[model samples]
Target: MYHYTAIQWIFFFYFYCFFGWCFESTYVSLKSRKLVNRGFCRGPFLPLYGSGAIMMLVVSMPFQDNLVLVYIAGCIGATVLEYVTGVTMEALFKVRYWDYSKNKFNFQGHICLGSSLAWGGLTILMTEFIHKPIEHLVLSIPDSILTPVTLVLTALIGADFALSFKAALDLRDVLE
Candidate 1:
């Protein structure tokens, strides 16, 4: 198993959240032919991706040596996370942030075979390639600096999440 301090894990999560936001925002903006701030939050972060990355790392620990097992674990783990998050968000907000209702082999418009397969591939790529350099960079940082930065980020993200949650609720009321 990989050993990481709590701060290190938090940093990894935040980093992945930012990265996911960059990717999603760019893709969405390109698709829509306009700039789009994509995510549940107004900030440059996506908690789902952070959570998914962490889950991928944790679930692939035992199967790290085997590519096939790693892929399988990622498929199952990420799919479950996506499904749960989608269901919970829709239930609480009365809106779906994403839907796969038209996709083949979809379940309840929340999860689908294509996404599960993509998650498996992404897990393999992240574990095998993307995370090594990131891990090194994070490890190289001094704890004194990293700790304070993490604390600040935590506060900012907390505030952003609160505001976003309120906005989502307000939108739900409007829709109702």
Candidate 2:
């Protein structure tokens, strides 16, 4: 059994989210032939699947002893997250990048292989491995540094998303 402090967990969440975003970006770029933002424009918001997986695993922290159950639970969480991202993005953006409405093995939407892999891998790592051991490693840091680091990282991600969105819109404008 492993244990981590509050700060470590926050750092882990940050790391997982960043890694998940990059992994999702690469996957979408390879599978959909577009970057993360482009994929968001051309396909469903699959990155949320990984983020959702992380959320699920975090929520289930108390029950990390069961690997199989954790993975299954994470998958369910990922599915719901996928749908939420899809619905929310549609409502917000007024367009859907991909349609899984008619596809087999899909529940009113598509969950691509890349997203699945990201979710599954994250589910395993977060639940079975990193949860407890890393807390000690991060807890030594001052609160001031931690707070600002998280804020800066979050802002950077937001900025990246905005830039990507602009580029995607520009491409759409050119195509039209």
Candidate 3:
């Protein structure tokens, strides 16, 4: 029943990316006793989190009345996304961003049951409490500014992803 325009979706993506980055960095910083930019992109964003949120938002649209189903779907969807992203990143970057090997019920340290359940619980919270207000806020922006902002943000995100990937691929120094 909730329909979002493309521009609204773009804003949602950016909003979630920055929010995820903040959540991740702060959590890591507290754990390490030092600040950390805990995101794949060099910018203050995390595409994986953003993509995961968007995917769940879309997937859970039909299950609005069924919170339990939404939560279960989120568990599976986020776990798959996390696993695939972990495999692809390790293969491409030759770096492990995260490892859950110490955790119980982890699959190749890529997807863990704890994290999956957390994702599901968060999905329920987001779908039930957060997303509607966010959608309203995003769509409230006037078209005159929304289009330009979305376009600019999209370009910046694209460039950030490319540059970060390029940095990860920099193995010449190691080879030497």
- List TM-scores for all candidates, in order: 0.98, 0.60, 0.93
TM-score-best of 2 and 3 = 3
Error of 1 at 22 (Å): 0.3
Best-fitting candidate, measured by lDDT? 1
C-alpha RMSD by candidate, in order: 0.7, 5.6, 1.7
Tens-digit lDDT string for candidate 3 (1-176):
66878788878989998889999999999999999999888999999878888978987888888999999988888888889999998888777788999999999998899999999998888787878788778778898999998899999999998888887788533533
Better of 1 and 2 by lDDT: 1
Model 2 lDDT tens row, 1-176: 33555654555666655555567678768998766443442232334433664576565665577776666666666766777877776665556766776655565565654555556666777666664354554576677888778677556656666776777666656655
- Report the lDDT tens digits of candidate 1 across residue range 1-176: 77999999999999999999999999999999999998999999999989999999999999989999999999999999999999999998999999999999999999999999999999999999999999999999999999999999999999999999999999999988
On the 0 to 100 scale, the lDDT of residue 116 in model 1 is: 98
After TM-score superposition, what is the CA distance of residue 158 in candidate 2 from its true location, in Å? 4.8
lDDT of 1 at 148: 95
TM-score of 3: 0.93
